[model samples]
Target chain A: MHEALRFQPVDAEPVDRADVVAKSRHLRRVTEGAARGLSLTIRGLRKAFGDNEVLRGIDLHIPAGQFVAIVGRSGCGKSTLLRLIAGLDAPTAGGIAFGEQPRAQDVRVMFQEPRLLPWARVLSNVEVGLGRERSSADAQARAERALVEVGLGDKRGEWPSVLSGGQKQRVALARALVSQPRVLAFDEPLGALDALTRISMQQLLERVWRDQGFTAILVTHDVAEAVALADRVLVIEDGRIAEDVTIDLPRPRRRGSAELAALEGEILKHLLEGSEDTSGL
Target chain B: MSLIDSLPRVGAPKLPKVDGLIPWIVPLAIVLVWQLACVTGFVPSRVLPAPTDVALAGWKLLLSGELVRNIWVSFWRASIGFVIGGGIGFAFGLANGLSQLSAKLTDTTLQMVRNIPHLALIPLVILWFGIDESAKLFLVALGVFFPIYLNTLHGIRTVDPQLIEMGRIYGMTDGELFRRVIFPGALPSIFVGLRFALGIMWLTLIVAETIAASSGLGYMAMQAREFMLIDVVVLSILIYALLGKLADSASRALERLTLSWHPAFQKK
Candidate 1:
């Protein structure tokens, strides 16, 4: 039911094929004994804040290792849905279950703001991802490795205030990836970045997501970005999934390609039409 | 790139080299004018002694070790009071800031007590502890307590809720959250409170010592006034100014060291 929707193109980048395979194999080995990616099953999730129904009823089933993008207007409850899935906020009704009963450390959320501890050094901030239970030496080793993964090894000792906006986001991504989580949720993480920085961060995110093979759910308002990164694009409207479109585009998909543009246009059309209908009602 | 090369070159106005010496010029000129007035008999020497007289008085006090002894006594008293009051204030602030139950139990009472001008309680303190070291210590501690307590509470209360939420999401326990997120976030404000409390500490000490004491600089100044020793009185005032500046500088240095992660403290 999901193979056609899945885009695992072996020839995505012929030159990097060997490197990708080696990294993915190593990643699999590391996560084999540990709790790997977890599949999400959200049923009739409703969240109301003092009679303001943010999420009317959200039902989303995201399979393990699948990348999903939720796109919607400002108040269309996409963020609310993401927050519920990340377990930051509880649903007013219904339930969300993970396949393996994921621990708090097994899931991580990256917000639009980097949300780095301003007082902590870059390495320390990333080490916080290991939770308070891990040994100091082990956490330090993993944190350094995560920083190196995000191309920030040299910046380990530096303070967050010293880093540029993009660098700060990269540190945040490193922090999220340090735990080797089974589920990674992005709440418009790139929304505050500049256009150029956003694209670079998108590429970095894609590379990490592909390597880690975690269940990734990105909440974004940027249609093009949603289409470019996600295997399946979900258009949320009136706190419901208005349209579920699968982007068959292969990995390492070109930015601003005609095919991606067409998909964006199709998604935007659905979103615009849905808004109009809601307004008319 | 070299450090100097990395510095901004374009549109960066060069600072005048002579600017460093400019501050001394005004003070020196003031001193010269004062000496000239004294020499020319424009002002009575008895009423307002010349700068030289003040320096000579300082020199005499330095030789007799009286100035150093008085300063040391005052410093020790201030230090003891500051540690006691500041420590208690910090503990109370943390308690009130963290738990609503604690706040409900104590914050109102604290606010009510804070309203009573601690200096105004000097007479009561004297009556309770007598005109001894305990009276002065009590006054100084009482005076220093409010600023630290109030600012610490404000600091902890005003810490970014988002960061605290992030800490919670990251699975930090209560202790870890306080140590990592809440405490560091509250530091800048706590430092502000410390500096304010230091000023209050000195002010209270001076007043307490002057009103009833035998040894401190304030007491020495009072003694000098009784003997019509204008130079000694002026020297004591200058010493107070110096001590205040030193304390402030020390706090600022600590602020710079601890808050290096803060953008406001980062060098351009």
Candidate 2:
């Protein structure tokens, strides 16, 4: 009966933050030493919408399999940077080249809205990620497997409209992961979900990223969420990477730990300080 | 602290179920009243026949096979006209929906013509094709065309732009995009057009057959009126109602089958 309540922990006990942090640091160090997932290198990427320049020249490098979160005030070009990387839009000036040349099927983006086709069932929506290359039978099999991975196996036949907000996002995640894309770009996909649902989604995302080893770039406005899920949190100001703060904490880290709170504070400090200069603009 | 919890809970009002015999009661009562009036001579039988008389006339026509033959003839004409008009409408809609160049070239002209009632074109059509089947076919087809064309165009235009962007990002080809996204999105509206076109089909057929027809339900009613056979005329009217109801039910069934994904169509 206790296990039926998804929000509650299976074993109710107070965890020692210091001990968990030490263990996670050790685990992360061991994993970091090994060959990681796909790496992305961006050199002076610029995007301008006519006279309004969204992203000025920017440069960054992300190690493969590493989860990086970009946080900024609205209209800071974080989303634009993501769109450029996803190949949804072209870069106006500087070039963005992957470590390995990625195909059209190699990158997927999950928008704030689930963007599920209303006419399609949840399983068929996932099958869309497979594109036109696979047979209907193969696509169906893969889609079912993906749905199971997202804990939506029973809901495969349901229309997307019937699903909850969190469920819709889960189906979107399944759709993105079905193709086994090397890079997954999230454009504040959990912004519309309730607080509890958002936390669960963040955990789900962390677990999926760990299992799949896909390079993930999350563009979010939540500073705590960025500190919680990302290996490194990037603070963007005026379309530029103002601060790159590495989170040395390990997996399954305590949410409200002093160490995590301190890191969040540090990132917030930099963000506030950066915003002061560009606030009027 | 808990405002919602503090509020009184009011149960929803229970609606009376009219799914059984309740709906039939009113029509049956109306028929009873009519039959009583006819029997009592409250209404002249010459102007409006008794319900029993109309039923007997229908049975006679059915046994003689005249009713069946005329219904078949009208059905064929309607089917042919619908196919021709609906087919052209669908093609034009697709062309205008997909290509801005085509829309710009033809939409204005089409809209202008659409404003002119097809019924008003009857004199011109009669002059061109005479009082033959061609005149009736042309009228029925013209009447069916506008609704289908307009709704199809509106459906294509109003499809969510965000879904199209998602499709493009996912590397869907133009044909695949149309099949997976645009077409499904537009289908509900297309069905709306089809239902409307069907109603127009019947209306046009009735008018055309009445104006100039040698054989059909319309012609049979006209022949009955000439002989003052009010019962036959009443039977013909009933037959038209039956046909219209059947056509509507068939279209609704198709809608249910195709648009099962739509929330509005889902069973409670």
Interface RMSD per candidate: 0.9, 1.1
Candidate-wise lDDT, in order: 0.87, 0.85
In model 2 chain A, the worst 10-residue window by lDDT is A1-10
**Per-residue alpha-carbon lDDT of model 2 for A1-281, expressed as tens digits?**
11122222212434444334424543553455334356899998889999988888889999888899999888889999999988889999898877788777778899999999999999889988886545566788788767766667778999988888999999999999888788899999999999989988887787667656789899998888998999998888888888888988876777999998999888777777734664522
lDDT of 1 by residue, B1-268 (tens): 4698878887867677876788679878988999889989998999788999999999999999999999999999999999989988989999899889999999999999999989899889888988799898888888888899989999999999988988998899898999999999999999999999999999999999999888999999999999999999999988998899899989999999999999999876
Q: Tell me how candidate 2 scores on lDDT.
A: 0.85
lDDT of 1 by residue, A1-281 (tens): 12221223222334344445445655564556234678999898899999898887888898888899999888889988888889998889989999988888889999999999999999999988888645666888888878866767778999999898989989999988888898999999999999988987888787677667789999999999999999999988888898899989876788989999999988888778824554421
Residue B1, model 1: lDDT of 48
Model 1: DockQ score: 0.73
lDDT of 2 by residue, B1-268 (tens): 2697567757754455755668679879998999999999999999899999999999999999999999999999999999999988888898899999999999999999999999999989989998898898898888888899989999999999999999988879999899999999999999999999999999999888988899999999999989989899999988898899889989999999999999999975
Q: Which ten residues in a row have the lowest lDDT in candidate 1 chain B?
A: B12-21
